[model samples]
Target: MTDARPLAFELPPLRAISVAIPLFILAVLLQPSVSARTSRRLRLALLVPTAVLGWISPFRWRIEPVEFAITANFRWGIFSPYFLMLAVWFGAMGESERKNELAWLGFDGKAEKKALGVEEGSTGHSTATKEDGNAGLRPRANGTLLAPKPRPVSPLASPALSLVSNSSLNDQLPTPSPSPPVDPVQPPSVVDAPPSSVNVPTLTSRKNATRSYSQRHHPLRILLDAAHLLSAMRMIGYAGGPRARDLPPAPKNDKTFFRDRLLAFYNAHLVSSACLALQVLDRDGILASYLSYILPHDAAVFVSATLARLCIGVSLWVQMKIGFNGFAILFYLLHRGTNAFLDTLQAILPRRWSEELTWRSRFDVREYPALFDNPFSKMGEGGVTKFWSARWHFLFRATFTSLGYKPTLALSKRLGVPKRVAQLLGAFVVFTLSAWMHWQALVSARYNLHPSPAGLAFAAAHSIPLTSIYPPPSTSLSFLDRNGTFVFFLLQPVAVFLESLWVALTRKRVSGWAGKVWTALWVVVLGQAVVGKSWLALGLVHGLPPLHLWSWHRFVLPTCSLAPMPVFMR
Candidate 1:
């Protein structure tokens, strides 16, 4: 890796911190006491530097052979956009609105006496009040309370998932059983303390106690809180909020937490192994020859090639799923380990920080949200709007909307545009941003390859396959073609418009069997034809290192004379 790009810019690695610094600053500035006007001013002041640093940061910072396996560094494509979007997201709204929005998004704005370990001797008593909306009240090991949290539902129980294995795409999914009514703002375990004996601390006292403790701890509180805030931002997946429409209803039984983790692991392994196997199969003209042999010789070359492109596109989708699962696993382990580490350290630390540490530890698990909804199930339901808005991974929805969609809509409305026209404008902007993000990602991934003569010569000298070292793309198509990634996303709004037009004329939504066919025709057929080939042209697959998880030519089909295992797979 070093040999491939010895003189590669050193600044790219340091510049990556540009995103984190602004986020930490925003976290600090958004604390409850900051006035709306002050927050607005501070945020406005911060936005300039944030945007500047974000724009200048290199996308080709962290690419190694290992990252190719997970495509982790591909995020560089969106890193700048995300920082810009997040900065804009914070700056666009004033303090009151921001607090309300964050509260609705399950972030507590109120200072907690228990959360800061200010309630010195009240270990056995519960401190939550009915008015304390969404106050998550879980008892600690020493019977103290943690901070307010919103209860999370199991991620794997999507109602749409019931029909995943059914051959018919149009199968109506079974309605999930409604969970026991939960308070939108408060967890059920929060038993309101009786006023007389409980001596509920006032807000001022809570703040005072927090201040005193922080003063004593000096920078520890600040550091921990910033880390906590950063982790919080990461944990707030998709920003669909707790009431996301696509989220499956919570189950009656409450034991799905461990089960959900297991499912995530299973999904990561299944999708990753499948993607690698597909990669291996697609290598060295193997899939092309196989398809040609299997299909009639009379089949048009265009048809066979289109089919191959579709296969590659499906593999791309699988690769994306692998990344999602990889992140999910990584987050779960990180949060769990952080909590355990905090617990172990708490005992050895000063007594004043014990409950504070406990608060932070529990906060890790309590606030962790599900990363993805059932995207396939979403697609099978039909309609591009449903797929994009509800079925797709929503991690970037807030970013796109804040950075593009909402602002456009607002500007259009202010300019006296019709509501529908404003909405359409917003949708287009969202898609445009989406296209740019994906295009940049592809560019970043390609840029990171930097396949040098030395690297190739080294491969050759060691009798290594050039494919393993990311040989230049064999296809004639340009890597940065606008017709590929850009067009695919850009055309989504048009498909959405067509669906809207159909609904307007027919007085019906685009759903059911017909909707399924319509969606497939647009996304699977048309989308894959352009985007899939574009990705292949960019040499995206060659970036992924082999997992060596069972070779297709070895265990799967020994009789077939397939190309030998590519490079390190053997």
Candidate 2:
């Protein structure tokens, strides 16, 4: 009571407790259950709220006030290990169950059999115990005799017996003897039995049995095996298997293992994508499929990490421009490494999807490349006509066309929109998202929000030159120029837009000229959003341009840097 007056200025502990209680409760309520479906749902439901709370809580709690302290990122750090453990645990559980199932199915040598009443050599007089139930061994009529019931001869035994008989026929012969009275009391022992015509199990049957056992005990083993298999298929060249015929052939002495590693990396990427695609294909409903398998909580971790890395990297770059050394190089390297990983992934994805789709349809890998190649080949040869004739094109067109005819279709339904409109919309969306991501990057970098003169100059120079006179450079060139702000702004939007156009045109929904113009304008705005003036201006004026001039002089002019610039020019 005496200290109550002094304590009045201090916030009550209950205030913190009150805020935390609800969050804790919500987290517990939203925690994923054991069921994959339930877990997935919980994960999705928790994502936005958790992220919001994570970010907000940091500010509320002042964990990292300058940066967004969303629980999403922290959750990734805290829960990722647990999530991974869960995946492994579930995977192992699935494997063990499969093994048990296989054993139950008689693939295991210890598979349950009808039990004999007595031990192999025990007298029949001994009472059959329940404990001896499934023993295959049986007591013979003679108290001392023990034998197994003869199993049915397999079809393979005859040919093997015939081969043996033919080889040994001339070497051994036995004289015929008159039949004698059979002994009543004697026990029979199977000693030196002629290599029984009982068909020796073939290698194939043994393999089948092994597979059966594996499948039974570990149902998920097959799935995990398939996962590994798909992964292996993806890694064929990278993991020291055969090279892809479709890809450029490897050099004989290519010791760098670049091709192999690249192939493996690509394959791994495809396997992940394929896993997601499979979930998409298996699930019922449109968004459900996309959300369920495609958008697992673990995936959010990956995406968040990528985004955070990018943001951190750009922030460091900006800080470096402003003479701040903190975190710049680390961010740069992280971004580069991540990009390389993603590039490998992008390269192999289409091939993986094509293969998956083909295999799912035809149940054969041989047809996969042909299936994927046919559409592209057709497009190259027949252009729009060939595309229309392709199966996928027809399917896509028909889906939208059918949607258009539906009486319940809403005005907001994009299904019946003209192909061009759809494409434009798609392009716009992708470009906008990309721009927003870039803008976030700028913010992270502490760059000025205003558009910089250097960025504008670079864009104007590159766009006017490349779009006007030349065919767009190869993807390799684009990749090389990826570091440049203007290049990315100009190129990425255009590329996304073109991709949208291709999709729409393929579906026969080509937009009018005005729509295309509008789309182009949107790209410019999006580009501006991504490339903050403060960051771009410094790089353009002091960094990239000077480096370019230096290289050009050193190699091309041979004495250019040595020469003085005009006073006015300087």
Candidate 3:
């Protein structure tokens, strides 16, 4: 008989976990104290572990499958905080700059200016003077000189004039000073000019004012700017309450405002996602193709998945607000888990793969033919081709080209059409495609699969319209209406229309009531979502059990057993 012996296994090194724990703890501790600025820094810091663990030697070391898998998963899990930190950080940084700029533009009030270290009436000017030997000069209260000078220098040199008489002649010829000391008359109160009137030098304006204005007016630019503005407002504790005069101009048309805000929110998220793509492409070379090609192949799938995540997150928050604790936590965990997985995969992949993936995912030959390889490309091929070859197209093309990827092919060849016209057409096409895809996905998913169509439709009908009328309420409504299926249907088309209108307006294609009608639709949709039955359904769904509890228990929630109804015999 052989003696039985237990097998001994060597444990894998816990370097990744060791590194992650301290940082995780630090981030948790710092969360409450994380101002917009610090939050960004913390996010950057979190990336250190992601980068380090991703590059750790001997990642192939074998342990128990469960333990190894958990560790590998944990490495990915860290990316949630990593990407989230970066998103919040980037948002905060951009917002801080935007608020400062807006305040400089005369949109923010005294308190905001003070909080940003912006002097009232300062006009972004530096107090430091150039050393042209005019250091002591100070402008007088009434725009008059204190004393007449013997010789007048150049008008430019007048800035050097001092309040006190500095000439030796005044010191020598002071014999009459003892006669009498007249009381100095009180100087008339001089009101300073408003800062908005002061011209501040800007690189964007100086380089090319027309281009700058056009770029700033671009729908994407407007959306990013709005995101920054909203972030700044939230940071300054002015997220809610009465309208502040210093805030950036609120959307004049309710529908336009709602649509713009939604777009801006989505764009901000995309930008962060783009960053992840860039990181992944830099790491994994070929595997990133799944993200770049397969996912983006069907625009509807991409939009639906992205929007669904957002809606679910918002819905979870809403459930939490309305006292549905269990559902909220479950939703939050699922969302976080999925987000973490995606973020980690991106981080772990090679940079080349990631870039290729991003390019393939965002643009396709079918949708964006201009980006395709064409042998006989020239001027006036078609409306779409003409639009792609315009001057604005070249400018936008150049912008993306400079970023190291050519979004459109044949950008090197100059088309006869004006740049702005082409750009407007391109922008319209892009927005329309994105919006339509999103709308189709939401409608199909909600109507086909949802157990409670009436509840969802009712919620959407009210919330959509209400959000347009009152934009702030949209955010809350989204949170309360878990899954945001209703909200998505209402908002997506509005966003598409707004983008199209913005492009048309840019190209002088349409204006006035036409614009207003398009804008109004967005407002109505948003309003319906905010005040709709969806809000009510959130409470109802949480209170009730799954429609087919036995089936749900067998598959969806295996931990729970269904209660059976008793039968009555007549």
Candidate 4:
């Protein structure tokens, strides 16, 4: 058995500087061209440069402990291929989302401010719209917009006096003369404000004109906007006229898109959060190690992968019974800590870099959604479109569309195939690609026992290391079989396709008691691999060492290295 280590990366300051010079030049020269051109063909051209850099990036290096062994980072240089792929994806999208894409990459844009109807800089005059009256006709102070103050009521205009048409006192009061015309360019002076002789009740249009909360200039708005941009990035395809049930309803207005108080929050946001959590799970090293402990074991033993899995299936019920791990307190802390650290990184980036990372926008806390539906919590009436697009949030939508959907759709049109066929074919390609990616990920596995049943886990570590430090496996497919991770993902498209047929036949969804039963059964059976993988990754196993959950060395004792998989950080 050969020992493999994660790729080693070191860019000495001088070498990094050398690399940065060329990258900077390329970025400046290509930014405009890439931004304007949304052609898939043009974006595909990026692959050449990316491949070249992946072959020769000076900053990155790797060494395996065993001779002939290869590292994961060796797959794609510095993850540049992934980074470039995402770049090409951003460039291929519509112009509207391009702003979002750029914002994520740390580009400054007036888009959010413009979208919310706020203009930059002082015009040295009022900037309010006619519809909003003079209430909005005020200059910003130190860049902060404030509500217009109310006019003071006069003592002479006593409580006893009634100006209403219904009051008998109305006849005794004289009507004021026509007021002087207000200058549009001239600033309104507070000292010269109209007297109570005018007897006009104060009306505030600021509340109605501006959103109750400001998204413009919000610090973390960029992150929120980045999240939206990333989610929407997956949906940027010509996949037929959108069906109502297929995707989450488009934001009703700018308010909902920006989450103004008046607009109701959409369900897709919750789905996005759920998808992100799943993504974090897979990227973290914990799941992979846990899977290794479980999957390569026999079904006969108690708390074997199967038994542990079954226990997992009933864990919520068990937790409910014990009333321990209540309210998911542990999970809540972990989520907050990780997100806080991520936000800190986002905030620390310089303006140019920040602009590249996100747009100027606020993540409206008011629009904060409660966890209800996730990618898997579907109840029918919704087809595969609804399943993947809305509920699933198509975590890899952008990648999938760029890699599979667009290419197939283009070819299908040339061959004159039906749109539905093209769509299903595209979906199949996506699933296949996903399965393949997962399969490749399985190539590198290191065994570790959970805290409890450690002896059994060690005993079950029977499979030969598919890829080790000495040399990599011949193919990622070598790790696959008829019934494994690949098959699990491959089966999704078929399930979705069949479910679509059922919806067509019945004109109803598979939800409620029936859907719940179906979901649980599917999870227990078809989804066992995924659940087991996740439980391990989450460090949820009974006897998994607490240190193993946080440290790379403990998880794979005797040695560890910086991994692209979040294991290094954990």
- Please give the lDDT score at residue 72 for candidate 1: 39
lDDT against the true structure, per candidate, is 0.49, 0.27, 0.28, 0.35
Question: Over the stretch 141-233, how does candidate 3's per-residue lDDT look in tens digits?
Answer: 321111223254564432222211222111110000000111111000100111121111121122223233333344433333333322221
Give candidate 1's TM-score.
0.67
Highest TM-score: give the candidate number: 1
**TM value for model 2:** 0.24
Q: After superposition, how far is residue 556 of candidate 4 from its true place, in Å?
A: 18
Question: What value does the lDDT take at residue 218 in candidate 4?
Answer: 41
Query: lDDT tens string, model 2, 50-119?
Result: 3344333322332121111111122122222222222222222221121111110111111111122334
483-526 in candidate 1: lDDT tens per residue? Answer: 48887877877887787677678877777778888888778887
Residue 38's C-alpha lDDT in candidate 4?
40
Worst 10 residues of 4 by lDDT: 184-193
> TM-score for each prediction?
0.67, 0.24, 0.23, 0.42
Q: Give the worst 10-residue stretch by lDDT in candidate 2.
A: 184-193
TM-score, model 4 to reference: 0.42
- Estimate the lDDT of model 2: 0.27
Structural RMSD, model 1: 12.8
